[model samples]
Target chain A: MIGAAQLLPFSLLGALVGADVVSFPQAMLSRPIVAATLGGALAGNVAAGVLTGAVLEMVAMETLPVGASRYPEWGSASLVGGAIAGWHPVMRPGAINHGVFVGIATAWAGGWSMYALRRLNGVWAERALPAMEAGSRRAVMSLQLRGLTADLFRAAIVTAIALLVWTPINDYALAHWTVGRAAAHSILAAAAAAVAGGAIWRQSHGAAGSKWYLLAGAVLGVVLVIVA
Target chain B: MTASDRAPTTIAPALSWSARIAVFTRMFAVQGSWNYETMLGPGIGFCAEPALRELPGGPDGPAYRDALARETRYFNAHPYLAAVAIGALVRAELEGRPAGQIERFRTAMCGPLGSLGDRLVWAGWLPFCSLVALLAFGLHASPLVIVLLFLGLYNAGHVALRAWGVSTGWRSGLRVAASLGSPLLQRGPQYLARAVLFLAGLALPLAIARVIGRRGLEIPSHDWKIALPLAALFAIVLAALLVRLPARVEGWRAALVVLAVLILISIAR
Candidate 1:
């Protein structure tokens, strides 16, 4: 069971980060790196949070949140992942992998919650149509505020619930995990690299003039990596 | 004829700077009430309500009601460029344009606004900034610096875009199409897209290197062990670059499947 003290702040953090996804102030504090760091800090493990976030960020690169398309809600979900990983604070394989797996699940659920909230907003809009048609300021404010408030609550609840449900699972998985560190991390890296590669291909393939830039950047990247 | 019969000579006296500020600030929440039926229509109205209340007849006036009601109708645009639509719409409203003409303008503006904002912000600037931040992480930048750099750079560009959109839209009004023709709108996407590709090219290798370097990966002290992994990772990335993904399948989605199977394998073990 999560202590109430821990639950409240994390819930609040999730709410704020989640809201930043599409609601108030899209300042990108919801980016996996930022959100995960915050989540990790809250859990007393900043380095672990950053490492888990870096991995998550790689996977996230493929998501293009365009035109209200259903994409993973990485913000609060990453926070949950960060928190899980942070609690252990070990540079081991299973903790990071377990955190990431749980985060992905949370993000998947968060996406659904967002979809549901949008539907709810649709219903509220239908109900408010008559008053809005008459130009009721009160009606407009009510719908807007209600939608915003609901999104916050949805994120908070999702984060809290994911934490409660997954903490034990993560613990158990870590406890039983028999994989070696190199094996576990190498596979994760390969998968992440594959995802990044795919994303690069998608962007450059039909675009004009971007390919050349990609080539030049690739050469430069090699030099940088070698020198660094 | 009433004094109201005369068209306003200037927009300034009719709508003050303060009103414009209110509209711009509210524009930040332009996606707050996004829904399937109206998309951002309600959000557009919410942002415009303050300005609508400031119409010639004030909040209680029929004109205010008409403007608010009209704005509350179906409308959609990228959240950022919606400011442009809102600014232009406000101008049309203040100028006493015919309702049909204003509606047509709003309809016409949506597609362009959506397309432009998507290309510039979503497909271009966002990816470009993300890659830069990723590169920093690969180079071992502090987490705080990475976060600050990403947020600061991204926000500065976007907030400026928003402010510029509102100002330009208001200035151009119904002729906002001409403003859209500016090099910034037309050429900005191409430049940013290229930048993204460049950064993607540079950052991705380092990313793979970082992954390979993580503590979980163990390699013997042999010099070849170090070089071998890098070479292999590079080859894999190159193959990935050449491989075209079928439509509707993304890298992450495929990775997730692979990951899930791997997780099962681990748990089963």
Candidate 2:
């Protein structure tokens, strides 16, 4: 179990990665694969983090953050998921699945939080409207700085709240898990693959010359599988 | 508000490298204030402020204020490619171009840059790199290696786009459309999409194998022989469902509910 003291740094990382989503550099660090893995490291279980991250990534592929389209915020959500998964670092029944559940839920809520932030920004922009109209450099800088600060705080709050709510549930689920290990692993794997399948379909659906590439890649994949 | 501020745009003296770099760096934060009203308008203003400081009023002057006001006004563009708009707009302001022309340029640049970056980065390159990393995970790569590989590969293209974008926009000014015609912008997404589709095919199988095989985590007494056939069958079925699942189905939500139900049942037992 993570102690109360450890939660601060964990939540802080969550804030940084969360801000990276759309606030700061927009680097891929906010990505599920990276964020989860980082969270795993923080929790002393890199493998656990990667496992959760892999599952999250498959579902996240379906989400494209194109201009203004509402999509789940995966950065902090994945971190929460990764931390939960890495806490015990056991690949046992009910371990990873619960984490993924928590992550998906956080991401869904994070999307709404982002929408709210947009409105809050509207309010701030309204306040700065006069100075902006006067072409004040201070006004522009102030708005950007305030917006950036608010987003960071938003991610931190979302992350802290998710961790508080989900950690005990994850522990309980893992404690009470009764399914055979094989079945549990198989079920989670199947869910992940299914999500990947949907994502792959979306990627290949209407693109020109994608079928050939997919086929060629499949052959290469098969050869690699057989060779290994 | 004056004739010169609204005069027809002409290529003006080159922006000092210092000013150009300042604008470039600030462009990264352009989406910080993204909102419903102006979308990226305020951010655009933020980035343009440094350059506008060079106006006769030196940040407090009428010329600076006029250009800053117009530049910062409502605007939208892809975050990565926004440097392009910033670069061009800075050049136009320095040249004392018409307000309407700068406004039109700002409006015109958004759709193309947004779609172009979306196609190039989001739809194309992002998934391609992710699939590569996924394959590495399947193959049991170390955590650091997998992360470094993904970030290094993804950011190479990401940083390059920004580095090139601002400069390109500055040089081309109103002629920025020509840059879009380049093979990298035009055909780049198509190639990346094809590669991503292929990588997706390659990675998915291996990932399924890892999942069912319980590879890497290497649980003791894991029988591959029994798991392989069952895993293959489950993979096919679930993957089909994922692909064919209707939009109406809230797949993730439903999955959560089902898991919750199962957990409750276990608790009851």
Candidate 3:
């Protein structure tokens, strides 16, 4: 029931943006920051939700989700992640560790779901190829609607599962595992850093000249932290 | 084949003014679950073919080619709004003009609009989203803030690109690029390069995520300052992977390499 409640908003957002990915007005609703915030708002933790979303946004920044290139479905992933993060007891009063973990796991699942749905979209597109080639605007619109609606259903299911399962799984794991709080937190931090590093490195690879930009961004980031 | 060989039904009636504009806008507006191949090529085909049939020659070989050329030129100028002016143009041609004038007009429009789409839509508007998203992150704003900022920025870009791309695709075609201060030839490759980089930027994050999963490493901070540098590092590694691949692998395969390395690192760790 909790999952269903959270999932509804994400499903709607995904349908809206996923449809927008190809249909209606092109909008940025699928973006992680926006999606996560919406998820957080629905979950009643706007701040935590946005925090988790921002992290996912940073981690997933390089994704364009254009064409056949499979990308993490931030629209749904952010929603699930934001909900989980916002709900975590440890995340209030500016503690972001629990929220971050939830965000990471949810975002990973979201990426997988996105890939799965891409395959589904391909199958549906093939089925609709005749109508697609028929030169009927309405026919093309129907095909687009079909794939988009399917995506909505897929995201909804994923969100519902994630939200329903997160707390139980988190408790079981936490109860079973005993590590220093710092160590456990460090591991999460390290993972986030590694992901961030990997993401940055990947982009820098594309533009060798962008090293300076990367360096500049890092220095600026550090400066902001020191000042804050 | 000569015009005489054409069937009588092939020469359909002209599209109305409103219809022309609709055709133009529909070009870019078609998207969501469909991939770029589907939307840009086949999707356009769906609208263009009918719009062509509604025209005098029913988008005859020359007409179809002309439409494609016009769309392509418009795409180049206003890559973001390539679809906006197409419907309107097709509608206008279908509605009928003096014989021999359509081709001339289409040809004229192709060059400028192509350039305009590239500059105004592709370069100008796309970067706007990045700026807003980046600023929000820098400020440590809430997810809602980033999302809202992105929405505002993207919509602004969208509206501007639509208005400008359509106007140029309609009025000057190829000259639209010139009006936007983008020389067609020189800017074309640069634009292509930029697109490649932007795509690379987008792909970098996912690639990084995969790598970290493989490496079993995590970041220590929830801040963008740390995140940005990490992203930069990931990009470089990706570039190196691209360089190291035996053959020139395109797209996702390259991402796979990054994933492979990440897994190796994870195992090693």
Candidate 4:
């Protein structure tokens, strides 16, 4: 079991990255790949972070954060995934698979949290309206800062909760898993590939001459891989 | 008033270099106070505060208070493009334009700017960069290198867009919309998106194949030699079919179904 002290840094990192998603900086640091990598580093394992990040990135490709749409929140979820992948005693063949599973589940939970956070923001905004309507600059600035602080705490709590719940579940599953190494790799690869392919398909499906572009890209990719 | 009928307004060069910097920095928090009713209402007001403080009469004056009130109205846009609106509004407020006119201008620019930013940044640039980063990761590049590559590629465009949007919107006001909505600007990202999509489509299967090949699955005979190519072909076809499916099939549902099938196959084997 990971110590509470060890989880603090990850929780903080999650808070920063989560706030980055729609608040301060809007840098892609909140992205699953980056957040997961940072999470892995905090947990004292970079390789586990990278692997978990890569898989999560493929799954996240299908998401499009447009307008007020409610999509899965990958930031805190990736942190949970990376921490689990890094801390597990056995770096089993299905480790990445398990990490991806936990990451997806966390993301779904994070999505709900995001919706809740938005509602919370609405309440804050409502309370500040009298001062805001009076054209108080201090009121406006304080409200904005308060919202950011709330987002930070929201991400931290989500990451800590997810870690507390999923870490034990992941460790137990890895210990008792029956699938052989080869089969596990093959299954994960196929599923990841299919998900990625579907994401790509959705992206280019309506565009003109998309099929040709796919073929061209495939050929180029194959040639590059072969050469390398 | 008609464009020519209005007296020639002197552009207030009053916003000092430091004030502009402050506004730009504040632009980063344009979504900080996001809410359902007002969306980015308070955030927009927050960004304009620095400029309001810098007006000729200073912070607590009527002009500053009016400008602050003007900014706090319902406003939302792509966060990146909000910089454009911020710059334009700052310029307008500094020039002492009517509060109503500036608000109308902000409202008018939101929809077009939102759609344009959405297309360029979210749909085109981000996925393309992610694909490039994935390629680098697959090739065993260092994690730092991959991180740098992803951030550098995505932000180069992102930072450039924010700077250009602000500067251009400041100078041209509503006229800047013409350049923003130009087909060339739109098509450039679309073309890049297509190219990136092609590369991703090609690379994903190759990566999957490599992973499968590395696992060294045992077969009864040489019959398993065909398995790799068959799997690759099936993936490509499956991708094509999924893409061609009706919009009713959500991406998440498709992914879950595929995942379930793979799990079932693994368990049975």
Model 3 residue runs over 4 Å out of place are A1-7, A17-26, A89-138, A174-209, A213-217, B1-29, B33-39, B45-81, B84-144, B173-269
Candidate ranking under lDDT, highest first, comes to 2, 1, 4, 3
lDDT of 1 at B111: 93
Best by DockQ: 2
Per residue, candidate 4 scores C-alpha lDDT tens digits across A1-228 of 667997798889889888888887888887777888777777777777776787777778778777688888889888888777777544565566667777777888888888898888888888888888787888898999999999999999999999888787767766666665555555555556666778766665556788788878788776765565
lDDT of 1 by residue, B17-49 (tens): 678788988887787888888999999889888
lDDT of 1 by residue, A33-107 (tens): 788878888888887787677778777777776756888898999999889988776555577777777777788
Candidate 2 chain B least-lDDT 10 residues? B2-11
TM-score per candidate, in order?
0.93, 0.93, 0.62, 0.91
Candidate 3 per-residue lDDT over residues B198-268, each given as its tens digit: 43334334322322222222433443334444554644554455445543343233333333344234334
| CAPRI classification of candidate 4 | medium
Every prediction: chain A TM-score: 0.93, 0.93, 0.73, 0.93
| Docking quality level of the chain pair in candidate 3 | incorrect
lDDT (tens digit, per residue) of candidate 3 on A108-133:
57667767765665566566555444
**Fraction of the native A-B contacts that model 3 recovers:** 0.13
Docking band of candidate 2 = medium
Minimum summed lDDT over a 10-residue window in model 4 chain A is located at A180-189
Per-candidate DockQ values are: 0.57, 0.62, 0.16, 0.52
- Model 1 regions lying over 4 Å from their true place: B1-13, B214-243
Per-residue lDDT of model 4, residues B44-111, tens digit only: 88987887787656887767777787788788788898878887787777777766678789889889
